[model samples]
Target: MTLLFLHLSRSDYKNFLNFMTELSYQCNITLHQSDIFSFLKEETYDLAIIDAFNPCSFLVIEKLGIPFIAFCPGLFINAGRVGIPGPLSYVPEYKSSLTDRMDFFGRLKNTLAFMVSSVIVMKMDALFDQVIDEHFPAGSRPTIADLHLKPELWIYNVDFSIEFSRPLLPNVQWIGGLLTKPAKPVTPELEDFIAESGESGFIVVTLGSMISSLPVEEFLKEMNDGFAKMPQKVIWRYDRSDWPEELNVAHNVQLVDWLSQNDLLGRVFVKHAFGVGTGVPNLSLNHKAFTIEQAKHWCYQTWKKVAPQLSYMSGVRDWVDQRK
Candidate 1:
C-alpha cells in the first residue's frame, strides 16, 4: 500500500515531510510538490492525508477512489460550511488590528462552527457508504445530507485522544497536536539570549510567516513595552533591519531578525509566549494590552491552545489515540 501526502504551500510541504520522516512508516510514500489535484490525476494511492487548509485537496480526493483523511488546525467537520453560505463563498475580511479581530467573538464563534461543520460534511461526502456499513446498523440507511448534517461524525480535535462527547461515527477521530517537532536550531547569538534570560521564565513573541510583513515598528514597540513591565525576558522575532535601537538594548529583551519557533517553544524556561501571525491560533496575542493581568492571561491562553499535542510523535499517533 502507498500513502500520498498532499500539501498546499512550500512551508506546509516542508513541515509534512518532517512529520512523515519522524513517523518512520515503511510504506511507499511519495511527496507531491505541485497542486494536489493535478498530482492526484496522475497517481493512485491506498490512503491519503490532506491538509485541510487546502480546500482543493478535498475536491480532488472526492473523485479519487481511495480512503482519505483531512487534517486542519482546529475543528474540521463544520469548517468550510458553517459560516459560509455555501462551499463557494468568498473568504471573510479580517481587521488589520489583532485586538479588534480577536475581540470579535461572534466572528470567531461562527468561523469555528463553520470549520467543524466542514470537516463533517467533507468526511461524509468522502466516506458515506463505508462509514454507514461499519458505524450504522443493518436496518438503517442514511442520506448524504443526513450524514453531512449528523453531529456524530467529528472524530478528532488537535489532541486526538479526547473523543467528542456527542454521538459520532467511529471513523471520525481527533488527531491534532501530533506535529510537535522542535523548531530548527537557532544561531549562537539567539541561543545565548535564552541562556542569559536565566531561571525566570521568558516570553517568545513571533507573528508567524504569513503576516510577518505587517508594519513591524509599531507592533514591536507594543510588544516591547508590554514585556518591559513583566518580570520575564522577551525574545522578539522580527524580519526587518530598522528596529528601534533603544528597545533592542533593553535589559529584559532580545530582538532578532528571525528565530526557529519550534526550537524556542521547546525551551525549558520559556514558560509563556505569544504569537501573532497567520494559520491557526498558536500562542497568539492581540496587539493591545490594557492591563498587566490581561497580558499575562493572553500569554497563558496562547500556550494552552497549542500545548495539547506537543507530546505526540506524529499526526497518526494522535489520530490513532483519538479512536481509543
Candidate 2:
C-alpha cells in the first residue's frame, strides 16, 4: 500500500493517460525492491503463477529465473498481453464498448481503441525502467513485453460459451465458472419478500462495489422513487447503514449488503456489468445468443472435454505436484 512514485501529466490522449497514471501511481509504484524482494532472491521456486494485470510481477520473473503461467484473473484485463488473435474487424477493443457485430464506424472506433491501448501499455511498461536499471545490469535488462510473452502458458478467467467466438493461441486456455457453485434455494425471508409481489419476480440490483453509493442526495431520491414504482420486489446490494437517514427506504425494495449471484441465475436474466467477458455476445455454441440452457450444456461439455486433456498438455498436474 506504500507509494514510491506518483507523477502524472495532463495529455491530449484522454483515457490512455488516465489509465497509465492510475496504474503507475496506485499499483506499480509500490513494487520497488524491498526486504521481501531480498527474501525472494534467496528462495528457490518451481514456477510462478502471475497475476498478469499487475505488470510489477514481471520483476519477480526477472529475479527468479523460473517458468511461469500468465494468469489473467479478469476475462479482458490486459488481454492483448498474451496476443489471443483478436482481429479488429470482428473482435471489439477491450474497453471500446463495441460489439462483434460492428458497422464500419464501429470497426473504425475499435481499431482506434486498439492503437491507443497499445501505446498506453508500452508507456506503462516503460515506467519500470528506473527499478529495472537499479536492480539489474544493463545488458541483462528485459523489456516488460518480452517477459509477458515468456510465460509457458496463459489462463484467462473466462467462459468462452458466454463470450464472442474468436481464434485462440495454442498456449491460451479458458477456465471460467470453475469457482461457480450449484444454485441453492433462496432463504425463506427472500422467498416471502418475492411472494408478496405475486406473479412479479424480484429484481436483483448490484451496482458493484466500486461506485455503489450515490453521492448526490437528489439523484438518490430520484433513483429510490423510480425503484418504488416497480411492482417486482427489488433485492439491492446496498449497505443499510450507508443509507441517508433523511430519506425513506423504498417499500418495494429490500436493501442488502450482499447476495448469492449463483443462487439466483434462473428463469430470465438481465445481466448488467462493465466487463469484456460478461457483455458482448453473451453468446454460445453456433452463435446463438441468450440461450442459457444451451450455453450451460456447451460450457459443461467444454469442461469435461478440455479439463483432462489440458492438464496433460500443460503439465499442470505435474506442476501442482512440484508445488506440493
Candidate 3:
C-alpha cells in the first residue's frame, strides 16, 4: 500500500515517520513525504493522512481521488462538518475546560464559541478555495465545503477522561496520549540533587514552551518569593542566566537552563497551570502543597491505562484494510 502524509509540523513529521517505520516491518508500504505541492495530480497513493489543523492542505488530499484519514494532533475541530456537536451544550471547547455537563452560562458561552469557530472555518475554506483555483483549473477541483463533507475517518489525539462526553461519528476514534513515552534517564547531577532532598523531595516548575519565553518579570518575582519559603527543593527551568538582581533565589531553589520535563515529571512533584501541555497524566495541584498520597492513585490509574508504549494503530489498520 502507498500513503501520502501531508502538512505536518516538524515534530509531528518525525513522529508520523516513526509510526510508518514500525508499520513497514509488518507490511509492504510505500510512503511519499515531500514534493506534494507540484505533484498532486501526477502522483497517487492508496491512502492519505492529512493534518486536520491545516485545512488548506486538505484541498490536495481531496483531489487525490483516494480514501484519506483526518489526523488531529490534539482536539479535533472539524466537528460541524462531520455532523458532531462541538463547544456546545455538553461538548467543551479546549479553552473552556468545562466537562460534558455545563451550567446555563457555560452552555451559552460554548454556543458562542462554536459559532465563532464555524465562522473562522468558513473564512479559511474560502482562502483554501482561492489557492486551489490558482493551482488547478477552474471547476476542476471540488469546493472545500464539499470535500469536507465526504465520509472519512478522524483520529483525535485526546481522550474522554478530561474531555466532556459527546457524540462522535462511527469513524471517529479517541487515541489520546497514544504517543506518550517513559521518561529518559535523569542526569547524574539531577539524580544527586533528588537523593539529597530525601523525604522533603523536589517540585518542578516549568511554564513549558508556550509561556516560557514571555516577559514575566513580575511573575518571576512572585515565584521567587514563593519558592524561597518552601521547604522542598525546587528545580526551576529558566534558561536566562541573568535573572533580575532584585529577586533573591533561595538556597533550596535551583535554576537550570533546561530539564527533561517528562523525566522530571516521572521523578518529582509538579503543580502547574492549565496551559499548553498540562492535561497529561499527572497530579493537579489543589493547594499550596499536596501529599504524594493525593497523586498516588491518579498516577497508578494512568500508568495502568496509558503506559508509555504506543497503542493507537489498530483503528488506522482496520480503516486502511476496509478502504482497500
Candidate 4:
C-alpha cells in the first residue's frame, strides 16, 4: 500500500524523513513525498499521514476528499475541539507546569492560556485557508476550521496515563513510544566512561532535538559551578566543541557531541532529571514532577503498550483495524 507523507518546513521534513526511512525498511511500503495536490490527484493511497503542525497540508488533503490521519508531535490540541473537558480546570496546556490537580488560581491561568492558544491556532488556521484558496479555485476548498475536525484518527505523541483524566473520542490514540526500539551497544568511549564512574555514576543531559547549544552564558556558568560542587561526574550531549574556559575548569563535567539517550536512560541514574526549563521528579519521590527515573519508567511502559499493538511484521495492523 502507498502512503503519502507531508510536512511543511525543511527541518520538520528532515526529522520525519529519518523516521520514515527506517519505517519503509521494515514494511514493504511505497512512500510519496512530492507535491501533495498533484500526487493525490494522480495516485491512490491506502493512507495519508499529515503533520498537524502544518495546517496548510491538512487543508490540501481535505480538498482531495481522501480519508486521512493526523500525527501531532506536540501536546493534544483536539481535546477541547473533540467535545472533551476544557483546559480550564483539570487539564494543563503544553509547557504549563501545573499538574492535573490544580487550585483556583492555577485553573484561572490555565483557562487564560488555553483561550489565548486557541485564538492563535484559529488565526493560523485562517491563514492556512487563505493560502489554500490562493492556490485552488475560490469555491473548491473548505476553510481550515471546517476541515480540522474531519480527520478519521489523531495519533498524539503523548500518553493518557501521564495526562489528566478526561473524556476522549474513539478516534484518538496515544502512540507515544511506538517509534522507540531497544538500545544498541554503546561506543567504547562510553563504556570506559561508565566503568570509570563506577558507584559514583554519571548523569546524562540532553535538551531534546530542538535545542542544539545552550542559550545563555550565565546559565552555563551556573551549571559549571554546580557540576564542580557535585560528587558525581556529568556527560553532557552538547553540539558545541568549544566550551567556555570557566566551564572547562570543572574537570568533572565532560561534554560530548552526542550520546545514546535511550541507552543512558535504560541505565540507573539519579531519580531527578533536570533540563533547562523542565524538572522531572521520579515516582519514588513525588509523581507531580518530571524525573529521569520517571521518564525511564514511562519509556518502558510505552514500549509495552506499543508492542502488543504491533502485528507480527511490526505493522500496526491491530491499531488500524481497531478503527473499525
Candidate 5:
C-alpha cells in the first residue's frame, strides 16, 4: 500500500527564495516525527507514488519497503542517475535557459549550471539523512543515491513534442496531457462571445495561474496598443479588479478577472496570424514581455518540423503491462 503527499508551507512563498533553495528548504523538514509514518507502518499499500523532486518522500516510502514509482512534474530529471546518458551536451541543466541545440559557450555554461544544480540536488536529497538514520539501523541505512536511483518507474508529466530528443531507460515513461480536460462550454458569456466572433476565431492570452497582473502600468498600455492592432478577437485573462482605470481598453480584447484557461485553449480552433512568443519567467515575480518577429519566425516553426518524427505515449502501455 502507498500514499503520496507533498505539503509545502504557505510561509515558504512569503520570502520566495530561489527555486532550488525553496526545494532544499522543503527537504530540510524531517518526517521521522510525523503521525502519517506511524499510520503508514500499520497499513499495507501495494505501491508508492511520490514527488520525484522531493527526496524525503523517497526515503519515507523506502522505509516501508514497498516498490514505489515517481513522477517529475517538471522537465529536469537527470537520467544519468540510472546510468543512462543525461549528458550535459543536449539535456539542459536546471534554469539554464539554453535549449538542447547549443554552441560552445552555451555548452560550457550548461555544464557549469548542471554541476551546480547536481550539487544542490544532492544536498537537498541529503537533508533526509537524519530521518533515515533514525528509522533504519546504522549498518543497514541506505545512502541518498540508493534511495533516489531505484524507483520502479519515473513518470515524466511532460509534453514530448516540446522536449529535445534524448535516450530514456525502459523504466522511464513519457506520458503527457494528463491534467488536460475536454473543453467545457460552462461559461455562457464566453460561449456567446466566441460564437459572435464567427470565422475569425478568438485568441486566448494568459500569463498563466501565478501571474494575475503585469507589474508595470506601461506594460498594460503596450499590451492594449498591441491587441488593438490585431485582426482576431482576443480573450485575455487579466485581473480586471486590479486594472488601472486610466487605460483605454482595447475593443478587440476582453479582459476578465479570470479565465478557464484550458477550456479556452482546447475550444479554440483558429489559424494564428502571429507565431508563438515565450517570455521565459525564471521563477521571478517580475516578468518582462517582448515581441521579436525574427525569433517568432524561427522558434515556433522548428517544433513543427521535428514533431512529426516523435511518438506520443510511446512505451507507456508496455511499461505498465510489464509492471502489472
Candidate 6:
C-alpha cells in the first residue's frame, strides 16, 4: 500500500519524514510540498494525513476517495458567546464559519434555511433505505464520527505526552512531536551561558518558521525589558542581522540566529514565552477585524490567543520527555 503525506509545511514535513522512517510498516511513501489541490491532479494517494487548519483538505478527500486523518492544534467549540473550549472537536460546523459568524437573528434564519436545505438534500424516502446500524455500532466501536462529535476521546500525539482532558477516538492518533531526533550538541558559548545562569532557568522565544524574520523591534524591546526584570536567563531566537543592539549587552541574555526549539524547550532551564502587540485583546473581541492579513503576518492580537505561555513549558517538556 502507498501512503501519501499531503499539505505539510517545511517543519511539519521534517517531522512527518522522521516519523515515517521510524515506523515498522513497509509502504511506498511520497512527499509533496505544494498545496494539496495542485498535487491532487498529478497523483492518487491511498491514505491521506492532513492538517485541519487547511480546510481545502476536505475537498481533496472527496476527490481522493480515501479514509483520511485530520490534525489540528486546537478545536474551537462554541462554549458561551465567542469563547471556545480548550479541547479540539471534529464538528463540521466548527470547520466552517457559516454559523459561528451569524448574528442572533441571522442564526435563527440560517437554522431554518439549513433545515429546509437538509430536507431537500436528504429525501424522506432515502432515510428508510439508509443503513444506520452499519455506521453506529452496538456497545462501543472506535469510530471517528463518534470522537468528532464528542471531545471525551482524550487523544494526544505520542512524541509529546500532551494529554487531553477528555477521551479520544481510537483512530484519532497523535504522532506530533516524534518526527525529529536531537541535534549534535549545543555550542560551547551556549552551553556556558546556560551554566552561568544558576538555577533561575532560561527563557526561549521563537515565533515558529514563517514570521521569524518579520520586524518586531518594538515588541522585542518590550520583551527584553520584561526579561531584564526577571531573574532568569533569556535565549532569543532571532536572525543575526535583525538582532537589536539594545538587547545585545545584557549579561543575562543570549542571542542566536536559530536554536532547536524542541530541544531547547526540553532543557530544564529554558522557559517558553511569546510577545504580542499591545492590540491583542481588542482583536480577540473582533475576530473578523483582520481578514485581509496574510498568513505570515503577525498580528499581536492573534498571536496573544494562539501564543504559548511560559508556564506551559513544563507541560511541553513533560510531553516531549514521555515520548522518549
| Candidate that scores best on TM-score | 2
* Tens-digit lDDT track of model 2 for 45-78: 7787987766667666767778889877544445
Q: Give Cα distance to truth, residue 303, candidate 5, Å.
A: 4.2
Q: In candidate 5, residue 217 scores what lDDT?
A: 78
Which candidate comes out best when scored by lDDT? Answer: 2
Candidate 4 residue 29 Cα shift, in angstroms, is 28
TM-score, prediction 4: 0.62
Q: Could you give candidate 1's per-residue lDDT for residues 245-274 as a string of tens digits?
A: 565545777767776666666332221222
Candidate 3 per-residue lDDT, tens place, 233-322, comes to 778777666677666777777778788776876433444322223344332332211112223322333453322211122232232223
Query: Which clashing pairs does model 3 show?
Result: none
Q: How well does each candidate superpose onto the true structure, as a TM-score?
A: 0.44, 0.66, 0.57, 0.62, 0.59, 0.43
Q: How accurate is candidate 5 locally (lDDT)?
A: 0.56
lDDT of each: 0.41, 0.59, 0.54, 0.53, 0.56, 0.39
Task: Supply candidate 2's per-residue lDDT for 314.
Answer: 33
Cα error, candidate 3, residue 323 (Å): 54
Q: Any runs in candidate 3 off by more than 4 Å, and if so which?
A: 1-50, 57-68, 85-99, 102-113, 124-130, 141-152, 181-184, 209-212, 241-250, 255-258, 266-324
RMSD of 2: 13.5
**In model 4, how large is the Cα lDDT of residue 115?**
63
Model 6 clash pairs are 75-88, 152-167, 153-167, 153-168, 154-166, 154-167, 154-168, 157-174, 161-319, 280-301
> Which ten contiguous residues of candidate 5 have the minimum total lDDT?
281-290
TM-score ranking of the models = 2, 4, 5, 3, 1, 6
Candidate achieving higher lDDT, 5 or 6:
5
Candidate 4 wrong stretches, greater than 4 Å: 1-43, 63-65, 82-117, 242-249, 266-324
Give the poorly placed runs of model 1, Cα more than 4 Å off.
1-40, 63-66, 76-157, 160-164, 181-187, 241-251, 266-283, 286-324
Number of clashes recorded per candidate: 30, 0, 0, 5, 4, 10
